[model samples]
Target: MNFPTHIVAVAGLIINDDKKILLVKNPISGWEFPGGQVENGENLIEALKREIEEESGAIANIDSLVGVYSNVQSYMGWDGVSYTPTKVILDFIGRYVGGDLHTSDESIEVGWFEKENVLQIIENENLKDRARDMLEFHGKVIYRVYETKPVYSVKSERYI
Candidate 1:
């Protein structure tokens, strides 16, 4: 028997005491929240925290799950040799607990931005959707399905 696998990833929308949102400037994804693919045996929350620290040098106190997004399209890897798996991203809302802002290999720039300005900062349409949901979270978790190849377009979205 064979089992199907999906690339599961986690991210945190971190807000500091001043109500500024944390963002990382990734070489590949541009200005987006800190997060990455879950490593083997790592729980979602743990992976989110690890990604936040690894990408932005900030410790976060995760508060709640904000949304779950499914990219139902498969795309070529950076090397252009093989197709990548479909991705399901779990996004969480959190508070910046401690640690000064710093950059890492995954993030060339890390800083806090006003919540209202996040959509303007993020270049990717899909990431903007995630950021928008995180900004407007009102005690509901959202589930969205989208495709990215031809253009970023939503297939479906609903509150969960």
Candidate 2:
């Protein structure tokens, strides 16, 4: 059954000089920007700031709302429990105003890379596309929806 899932969230598509973007490589594998789920009763901007701080240990000022994404896919647990088919995430463009980029409990290595260079190592095709869209469009916002489901569970998927 398709359950009602309106998980409001915020993410930072942070950028720097030389057309470089900030991304993190986990202690495991793959690469992604700093983001997390927005908590109950918290404003979107507040959630973005809090997630950025916790994930990258940097204080950032959100620049603008870039886009809203909703992708529906199947999910299954390690123990084989079926869950919701899709989870939607709201993302924003954020700028690092102050603080240092250091490793935190949520990340292992964080660094900025050239836009061309970053595209190759992102691991997930969809995420790479999203990053490219963010860079190319700049202030232009977008809304995306997915109808298909993944063969593997969401937990095993590279990115959410």
Candidate 3:
């Protein structure tokens, strides 16, 4: 019997004092919330803070968990390779602590965007949906699951 492996990740919808949402422009994922895979031994909140700081050079105070989003699809690996996997993303609503916006190796651009502008700039449907949900969230945690096709062809030999 084959069991599917799920990659756990975390994302932060950081809102600044100006009511703008923090966004990062990743080369592969495009404009989206700042986040990455949860490191071993780190809790989801810790992972979210670390990822936000690493990717956007900003400090985040986690306000609450917005939702859990699951997407079964092909995604670019950290090594620049492509792979199909089930990505489980925990989304959090965070408040900006401090630090100027700057991009790291993982992000091409980092900046704050208005809610309406965020919806326009983020082209990925999943990301756009997540942002909208975060904005409309009313103290309740939500769960969403998405089904997607592999963008690359898989060979039986590769798996075996």
Clashing pairs in 2: none
Task: Estimate, for each residue in 1-160, the C-alpha lDDT of model 2 and write its tens digit.
Answer: 9767655667777876445678876654468777878899898889988988787777778886666676666456335775654557677777766677888776888888777787787876556656665666556677776533443222222222
lDDT (tens digit, per residue) of candidate 1 on 1-160: 8897689999989999999999999998799999999999999999999999989989999999999999999999888998888999999999999997899999999998988888999999999989889899999999999999879999999998
**Which candidate should be chosen as best, given TM-score against the real structure?**
1
Backbone clash total, candidate 2: 0
Q: Please give, for residues 51-88, the per-residue lDDT of candidate 3 as tens digits.
A: 99999999989988888877756566668676757788
lDDT of each: 0.93, 0.69, 0.83
Runs in model 2 lying further than 4 Å from the true structure:
1-3, 17-19, 27-29, 77-85, 147-160
Candidate 3 lDDT: 0.83
Clashing pairs in 3: none
- Could you give me the TM-score of model 1 versus the true structure? 0.97
Worst 10 residues of 1 by lDDT: 1-10
Residue 43's lDDT within candidate 1 is 95
Worst 10 residues of 2 by lDDT: 151-160
Better of 1 and 2 by lDDT: 1
The residue-level lDDT of candidate 1 at 56 comes to 92
- Output the TM-score of candidate 3: 0.84
By descending lDDT, how would the candidates be arranged?
Answer: 1, 3, 2
